[model samples]
Target: MTAAAAATADGAAAAARARTAGGGAGPAGAAAAAAASADDDPFLAVAVPPLPRQLSAKVQHAIISADSQLSERLSEQLGLPRPLILELMRFGAVHYCPVMPKAGPNTPMTPEQLAAASAARAGAMARWGPAPKLQVPRRAMEDAPATAGGYARVHLQPKRFPAAHTTDWRRRVLHQGPDCVVVDKPPGVQVSPTVDNVLESVPACTAAALGLPLDSLAGLHRLDAGTSGVVVLGRGGLAFARWWCGLLEARSGGGGSGGGGSSKSGGKSGGGSESGGGSESGGGSESGGRSGGRGPKAGNEAATARAAEAARAVEAAAEAAAATGGAPLRKVYRAATLSPPPLGRMVHHALVGTRRPGEPAHTLMLAVPVEGSAYCELEVVQVKPIALTGAAAEEFGPSAFESDIRLVTGRTHQIRAQLAASGCIVIGDLLYEAVSARAAHEAAAGERAAHEAAASGRGGGGGGADAAASSAAAGDGGGGTAGGEAGAAAAAAASAEAATAAAEAKCGFAVGSAATAWSRAAQADPLRAIGLQAHRLAVYDPERRLGDGAPAAADLGPGWVEFEAGVPWWRA
Candidate 1:
């Protein structure tokens, strides 16, 4: 190997050794080791070729120009740091191609190389196929101080995130495999940190649980903070890519034969039959073996029946595989809301991002009322990869409905936005315009307060005579104002009891009980009381289909597994 490559290998080996030695120290030690092991160690440095002085000068000038006050302002606007912006520019890590403006191939450049480089870039772009690009050294960029004008689309690397809150990984793991791990992500836990916040995320937590390096874990998809559900994480880049592709295929209805919409229902039916056959076979084998004196004809018939069942099982497995296009991904969710939805299947068609009509998005909603009240309903919403025509700017009206949402397309805030647009907001979804449950409690409290004040006023008015009589009695007994004060205290205590009873009736809770405290707490923060109950119900992996037999762990493919996180807390 070349000297540079060999040095890089050595550095990597050193890092591995450090990690192994410090494994007991946990994530902090791993991070420290990585930080200390620089990719280019001066001791192992090789004689690398240097950049031409003229080109270097041009790059330096470009970096100086880009890192200006203007860049800082742009960085703020873009929600990126000023230093990051400069680094991106200096390293040419930004998306745009950097080219010299105008100088010719044989022209003798002046002392100021910036002007020449700009001239060359302009001339080259004016003429043709490819332009002479300006290259910048990464090391130079790293050492450079923050300047102003440099701006680019900053792709920030994931940093070592400190766990923001305590999380139970054992409870979270729905399925774990060599290629991936599926977790029942709790609400309020972020999928990943953003530009501003470096809070703990699902991937980070997964890494901790598995004792793997953070960089080794890749998040295949994301769920919103309020959305509690199954989150899939790939063990590595290759695994993540494969899983992501499968998810896309499933979403796009690219899976052959069984349109993506029908896969869930089909799988359920097939699974039932397969399960039934296993039970029947088990019982038949025990009975037949015990009653071993059957005639040849009877034995032949039983064998025929077993063979037929096996054939059916094989057929079913094949059908499932064809239907799912061999993709190992299925997602289902359960949501809760306040208002009752219109029962049955309803299709919601709209554009995803910009309101201006584009490839219209489609979300199929199936509403079923939750048994209890007319105000609440349970919906099973199926999102297909199908595109519908038309603008959904004003398609749905304001109504409350909870949903069992199955994602057909893994879009950002797909469930929340679609449901909100359809007038069925998930409970505790503050981002959307759903009516708050707290409003009703506030109104009730106001009415109760008014009633109590009026009643107290009436009681005070009526007690005046009693007070005067008590004072007269006290004067006769030589007790003075003390007797009047005692009488006043008794009246106040009676009023307080009456007020408490009235409050119990108003709040629909027993006085001074746990239920009363809970009611008060609910009124204080309705969001917590009635949380966004979106849970991942089940996930199916079609790639792991069994043929006429029970599936063993070895039969499962890379990134292949099924998981089910039961109904959300509200449903239970």
Candidate 2:
């Protein structure tokens, strides 16, 4: 019978057999015999349906007589039981040979399942081993090289760190308390010269500048190259160690944000939560409900309380930072941009919290937008030392436009992501400038190739005329870097021309009524530096915004103006 038909027939036949068995078991001695038989006979008791007509009798007979001598003999020969052998045979008849299924496509087995089946077959083969053996001849070992002891003694040069600076310049100190120093670091330099002794970098430079012995000075902290700020240095090793340990502990507790827990603070000294905390507020409690009132009581109140405690801890660290000199050193920054900021634009962003000294941590962020941009920017200045806030929430609510940020923590790559996430990516960013650079490169190469190709043919034609004019401009203009005479001349001329063009373009910007007023005010006043400008991007800032809190254009002041003064070597 076909498989489906066979299945149906087997079911009917099995039902009939059960009825017959049931009726046969009813009388006097028959009941006892049937009960005993049921205990020992698997096939008679099992509920499995029968197989196809020809196969069913043989399979059932094998199972019914599974404990008989014939069954034992068959099982010994097959390495299994009589019932298992019969079932295998029945399955082979139905499916062992390849045949198309009802469906057009074949069903696929999972790789793992297929592999497991293959492994099972292998195990079976192993059980009845013919003991197949194969040999792989081993190669003879070569004699050890002569003078092995001498070779081992040869010293190797210390490996250098790629893309990292190294110098013999180093200074060490031992101190028992906090100390600070102002290092005269070069503008195009990094505070940490090498990873091994991060403190050695700026301190070494400070030693050199002060004409102090190399072993006398020690650096406690670092500043970004473009920052050019005072670096707090400690004196003896013990003292420096104490300060370092305290600083480390403080930052880890989410109290002072820097190096490690950086991105969480969003560049604010007294980072506050939406509910208020840290240098600005206390922790473990919610700010008195605004007009919004209290949220329903759930297990969540504990979580809010915990958040508040964390804020208080952060504030403690800020207090520690401030109290170092009886008061923390105040820092100020100036940024120049393309135009004046819009009338009144302020954007608030949330600063996520990070790990404590003993815990592992990460930052969360939200960006909000603000007012304006011809070339949008903002200046980050460390305002003052304030009491710590220990309230429940540490971040601010979202706003409308893009915003620039300062760093409260020293986490890596925070500032770059923060600015980009806020919507206004910083100008002239190397790592983040992929799209713009690629386009510019393609365009420049195309123009150069076309110009060169044109020059190669037709002497004194369009190319010759252009070439002469270019030569005159390059020779006369003083606007580029030092190279060979022709190269330098060209570079110079290009630099001058670019600057002039930039100024002209911004002049065009001044035609707008808002910008025109800014220009007029600048021309009218001496202290007011007017016109559009760009920033000298710096490294050391790390904090980014995420989610709905990105900065808005409205945050930029009146003219959307910002600018940079000194050249920057390090980047955010």
Candidate 3:
């Protein structure tokens, strides 16, 4: 064959091999062509099975009431995600009337029957002066037991409380007297029994501690289950009444007069009122000898009479003060908070209840910074009760601040609600900004990581990096001990371990302990876990005289008393 013909054949053969290797003309080519065809025509592709969307009980009810489109719109308006709304419907969180055509014999009308009856009554409303009587539909769970009315009813499960044995109430006594006892109450214990709880109340625990009957003891003031603080309880009804009267008088700005008078009289009248008359007589005798004696004697009589009248007036005032229960009482508290309020700002915010215009609530705060804490920036605030007045409620924002709170009004959840309205939610307060602190913690953790990273390394960016490195080096150098930085870390770990041990001991729970029986209790009740720092540091009654020339123990009055609890170990 000619050379040109051979070259042409070789080129054609090379082209054929290249086409086969590149998957241009074989099984590979066919597969590629098929994939291309599937891509171009979606129907040719293998179908991806759609996921089954689960609907909750609420979502199911919503869907029953409206179409999917309407449900979606409702969810949007309610600020709920579509998936959550559907899930709620599927779970039957929402209630609806079960499908029924007629009322059963000897039973009330079913929800459907009631609806029909209502419609009929409405149609005949023009003929009658009053609308026809119709049964209202009873709400029920999707999977509830059927009742006599031929409709199901959902009985809500009652909440369970932690067993009394789970809490250790010993060693919480702050002070005890014949009239009253002050207890350093721990968190999670109720001040009084409610419908859902009968045990683990402050009154019950105090009565048990004092070996008195529950009926014999009465609480003077209430502290929330979440708040750890000093609780005062009277030993009997008389004691309670006296203490309550004193507290009311103090709140009403009618204390201190009796105490002040008694103090002044005791200080000045040591030798009796006759000493002043004698002094006047002696001075007149020196001025005019025996002639002036009778004149001075008559003057002394008049002066003595005036003095006696003044003494009688003071005595009457004192008696009136005691009778009216004008015993001065003051409450001091220590709070740990997130925001650092001005050193001495008196917050006068009005708090309203469920059905009335709010009363004025006043709190005097003194903020102090907490040093060297990695958990969160905290301030130690000293709170003193000021005054509560009948005032209109004030508006406030929803931000959170952590502070030690003291209640002047001693109203229900006064500190919690007031502080929340003022935009300072206590840490771990679920009713307020529970999620806020957690979010802040996460953000702080990230910042701390960055800070540590910056501190450990040498200069890389600006003066800030150099300064951080220098500071870290200084800290390392300051550790001067054998382990240096390692020693500091070890110390920190040991401190943390000690704190954990103390917490475990205080809480009466240990790792893997049988406390799990009551573990579900706190989880069932969110209020049990909220962190409210309201420690009653001290309480004072002005009518209770102390120090030199004060009355003996046997001479003390019913409302005259004082009690104090030390700072919490965490703060100490």
Best by TM-score: 1
Clashes of each: 23, 92, 30
How many clashes (backbone atoms < 3 Å, residues ≥3 apart in a chain or on different chains) does model 2 have? 92
TM-score of each: 0.38, 0.27, 0.35
Query: What local lDDT does model 3 show for residue 241?
Result: 36
Q: Which tens-of-lDDT digit does each residue in 356-475 have in candidate 3?
A: 122111111112323321111122244432221121001112332334533333323334434544445444444334222222333444544444444344233333544444445435
Candidate 2, lDDT over the whole model: 0.29
In order, the Cα lDDT scores of the candidates are: 0.38, 0.29, 0.35
Candidate 1, 57-119: lDDT as tens digits: 111123223333433544556644444444333222332223333445775656576464565
The C-alpha local distance difference test score for the whole of candidate 1 amounts to 0.38
Sort by lDDT, top down from the best: 1, 3, 2
Residue-by-residue lDDT tens digits, candidate 2, 415-470: 43233333333332222122222223344445444434433332334334555544
- Predicted candidate 3, C-alpha RMSD: 32.0
Candidate with top lDDT is 1
